[model samples]
Target: MNQNVRNHRFRKGIAGLGALATAAAGLFVGTAGATADTTEPVDPQLAVYVEVNSNDLANVADYTLAESGEAAIDMAMIFAANINYDGEKAYLHFNERVTETLENAQTQIRPVQAKGTKVLLSVLGNHQGAGFANFSSFEEADAFAAQLEDAVDTYGLDGIDFDDEWTEYGANGTPQPNAQSFGWLATALRDRLGPDKIISLYAIGPTYTTTDFSLFDAAGVLDYAWNPYYPTYDAPTVPGLDDRGRLGAAAIDLSNTSAATAADFAERTVADGYGVYVAYNLTATDQSAYLSGITEALKGESTVYRAAPGDTTPPTVTIKSGAKYTKGDAEDGYKRISFGLHDEGQIDRLYVNGVLKDLTDDRWSDLNFVKSGAFGAVKGENTLQVLDVAGNTTEVSFVLTK
Candidate 1:
């Protein structure tokens, strides 16, 4: 079937999930006392999509072997896809023929699903682009979607993401039917898969002056349309604009926004009648902050909280003594300390003596501290405190000499 015609017919048969109504209701409750000129604030939901290249998994596993296999899975939930496609084929292709990659991803992704995290399968829309591009017609797109649907069914993928950035390379300097074609494609997919699945698009935030929201409006077919906020690509560096303006600008320029951008996007998505998710390339030092922003945006407060005073839950810490240590003797000369913490709200700050350590550093996974400190151990008992995200102090304790 011709892709466009099929998409049109499919869209005609399905209806959106009524996300706008939910958005409207949320807006009414959130903006009860607003003035006529004051537009309802946008409250976007925040999520991160990790672009996992199958080619890169071995490297990732190698780098994270010192930690745990689950680390890769944890990283998977932060972003949308394990494979990046550039519209080249109807299905995922790997440089290595080993099927273990798929099996490992499925195993790793399950924990994320258990945590109720949303997963998206990303595909590039441009035929001439990188990753998986160069399809000649809409039938190819349909065939690809079918293969993708099978993968989704097998691995429990949450949805599909369409990213088409090749309009700039076309003649006449216009994207011509690209957005329309994508809209139709999304509609058809919605019809075939039903409303429970999410269909998202990645568009140039600023450059694309016209958008056919009708496709999204039809069956609420499009769940999320992600406009990247990379500093170099979409967002502007200027200040003083409302959060939405900042985000919109960021979408256009691909610039990085402040931590507040999370809150801003959450607000905007809620206001604009769309589900929202943010995209950030991960780094070791910024993980905590990124998670902090996401937690606040999603749940309206930081999940990391300080235990109130008088709270009696003793903070527990588990230490892993490396293999280099002698049995029955304290491993005193170790270069790092590895531990897991379950803070039931009484710990304040984790400290090595009196010095503070950053838990967001890349070396953190290696050091094994939950939050703060790079590398250093004081002789005798080491004090560990449970604290809230607000910095309120709660309980303190000492770890015995190893």
Candidate 2:
């Protein structure tokens, strides 16, 4: 996702859960005199992935340990670096601010790891051209994949969250969108890191309809598919995806809604049979309450996480614009995207990039087609998110090359 100024970009721009990955044997064993050793994290269901870039070592406590009491989710997907893959291999580099957090991994991540909360290192995509041009070929990824494995060992990380936000600018992080390569990487990771290690992915727009992720399921490598960047993407309904409902989950961006709204989403997400993942920015909100509210609302289901019901499924939507949003040059003209939504429940609201639409007529089409120009669609990525009265959500994200 291309970032705003206040938030520190992991690399000037960059880029969650499922089945219980077995913690690496002896991986949680503490080094000589480490403070938070032996804390082993449980299989996290209610999770949060936070960015460490904003703190600058300021009063803001590190995210995982910031909460006063027990954590709401069992895992914390922490940002360590922005990744880039050349034609052959993948590489990651951390922002100066994140570098500091990594330095404190022992103090920050270790304890969480020891406490049974999996502390994952989230690696995003590149800002450079072809974002993931490198490492697209599985053969070329041996070394690159090896490096990733080393990272897990060195940092004592549980596993990786491949946020391949392909098709979006700045945040587009796929390694050439090669499904085989992705599956191979996961396979390699399982072999190298341990089968019990968790492997999660981005249930982004393109990935939902494509077979790219099925390879992961065939390999039995995926733990869950976490949705965050896109506001309304429901979990994919793909067969053979063993962990789809168990580890596959959805997330709420705090910046997009209020605590009450977040709670509502979490409730619906939990009710939907899938787990819940929440993405938080350290610099943006009141971290304590944000963490606490979800924790409190999720009472009784902490240990045995809630599973989403078939009835709680979100709506289905499509952007008639086809693929990309912006047609051509900024002067070429705006594209009118005709879209529709369908859910078992009535829609409560519709939002595009965080702004509400005019739906006073009550007819679905009233908010259907959007002229990019009239709706303030930007030159890059644009999203159409629809949430129903029952809390089901569906969203579509497309690129506008203006």
Candidate 3:
């Protein structure tokens, strides 16, 4: 049971106790250091930040490396989350879509992780004065670090990526940006998250202007840092971080960036011995050709588009053979009713009596909810609704005789 779906159900009223039983089944793929069978990540990595607020995170798996047959993008970053101050303290806050993505990590995120592409959540500021550089105390930093570690552990994320922006330091009665706070927080995160877990920086804003070197192990704590601007070549000048840890050229916005410029960025990244190339805001539209410019320049191979265009047809719900209420065969209320849903387009939502009961990305031909008492069938009329990713919907209603 996805938490978002569960929340939806609660707002609409209780759907069933059956949903609670499936809650444990929604396990995250795994944490860092758990990639035992995955392909080793490529060098001179092509990392992309996916805007989950607007696009599907699963889009990260759509591009494949032409030569190695692995994920073309080495890292898939969740574009952002915020550190918000809620009067008393600062805490991590994920927007609705980010929460949905993480809650559905097994379906939305695991496919990319399965391809050996690391998935990281990028944390930034929300103008509430809760940025990374204004922690005020080491304990405050450690407390925030624990929240991040818990999120990683709970969601099976690869690690954290820091993007220092929009913090509005000195607002909301919070301390202004300090030199030691960022280093203290980063150090505490590295200490708690373990060595294999990734810790990256966006290499812009206060993370550069305010971070102090002697307070934190820059080389040891951060795994990668990339320039935040687009179509530019400027490596971050953080002390202790080397060239291989720095990705200094050709950050691009896929929706608007020029391919040739991206190619030049990749060319520079490789020629200058930078360890990573960065792209942002990948969408459902195919960008293999645009991405190939970077891949060909960096890896000497073309990028492959492996995603099939989504099906647009609506899904169907049918009363299966054993459904007594629909057939008018059982006068007494039936505890179990059988039904099947079919969709080549892939069913993404299942609603019962106007409440969301299940959500998934899996395509289905004939999925049945026959067991577990027909997913909490109650006396009187019941309605089942099904929908696909393309927003097509189908609904069926049946009445149990009193």
TM-scores of all models? 0.45, 0.55, 0.66
What are the per-residue Cα lDDT tens digits for candidate 3 across 1-402?
123211211221221222232234542111111112213333588888877777889988989877667678888888677788998789999888889999999888899999889999888777788889888899999999999999999999999999886778878898888889888898999999999999888875566666786677888888877766654555555566654534444477776678878888888767667777888778888899999998888778888999454456888776666544334434554345556677777778877666666666666535354333355445677777788877898877666543
- lDDT string, candidate 1, 47-141, tens digits: 44442332222222211111121222122222222223343333453323223434676555554555445556554333223222223345654
> How does each model score on lDDT?
0.39, 0.52, 0.73
**Model 1 poorest 10 in a row by lDDT:** 60-69
The 10-residue segment of model 3 with minimum total lDDT is: 27-36
| Tens digit of per-residue lDDT, candidate 2, span 128-162 | 42323234565655555677788788877788776
Model 3 ranges with Cα > 4 A deviation = 1-42, 307-402
Model 2 ranges with Cα > 4 A deviation:
1-44, 56-69, 85-89, 129-136, 166-176, 205-211, 216-219, 230-233, 237-239, 242-244, 247-249, 282-286, 301-402
Ranking by TM-score: 3, 2, 1
Q: Highest TM-score: which candidate?
A: 3
- Backbone-clash count (model 3): 0
Runs in model 1 deviating more than 4 A are 1-43, 53-101, 125-140, 166-180, 205-219, 232-277, 284-286, 303-402
